[model samples]
Target: MRNILTFLQESNDTAGAAHLLKTSAAPVTGSSGLSGKEIFAQTCVACHSADGKGAFPGVPDFTDKNGRLSKPDSELFKHVMGGFQSPGSPMAMPPKGGNTSLTDTDIQNVIKYLHEEFGS
Candidate 1:
């Protein structure tokens, strides 16, 4: 509990998370690692916005429990990597959430960002 809160309060969780997401088992060129905040700005902020409220109609408020970190990491990865086509969403999540070039690590990093930003 104390540890969790301390971890959350630290600034690097987002960077750690993004680093986890961007790297692949095989190192690749042109790969740039980002912090959680950077990942959010580059990828999620467009739809989710800075305040964590979604900009699009179907986009959920990140501050809400139903948003990105609400699900398991694997599930979020699937939704982010494959794209969301669920009913009421109107918009597709797009492969890698529109970052088609993102590695699995990148997705994980973004998930980490979400967890840090929205999870309890």
Candidate 2:
């Protein structure tokens, strides 16, 4: 298993995360060579939680079949890249999950990871 401490040490906030993610060692391809899972781990796990169940009350549960994944991948991509506020949710999704350095491919890869690992 990847160490959470490494991720935290590399990035403590959104901007830091973005910088670290862009400069981190290569892992896969199309996203600085980092796999979707690695990007998610380094950039997303902070708010979405390790299991993708979300850390805060208003955070959408990626694990729910009827939740965020229910939307089309394109919609998810837009929301992730541009950010969104669910009508009834208390918290809003930050653009690129606050990691501005995330490329389109990186976002897409993270989305793919969410679907494959947490989607119902």
Best by TM-score: 2
lDDT at position 17, candidate 1: 35
Off by over 4 Å in 1: 1-31, 66-68
User: Lowest-scoring 10 consecutive residues by lDDT in candidate 1?
Assistant: 1-10
lDDT of 2 by residue, 16-86 (tens): 34434444433323345677898887667665777888765666888888888899999999998888877
Q: Evaluate model 2: give its TM-score.
A: 0.71
Task: Point out the worst 10-residue segment of candidate 2 by lDDT.
Answer: 1-10
> Candidate 2: where are CA atoms >4 Å away?
1-31
Residue-wise lDDT of candidate 1 within 11-42, one digit each (tens)? 34444334334433222223248666676666
What is the alpha-carbon lDDT of model 2 when measured against the actual structure?
A: 0.69
Clashes of each: 6, 1
- How many clashing residue pairs, candidate 2? 1
Candidate 2: residue 118 lDDT (0-100)? 87
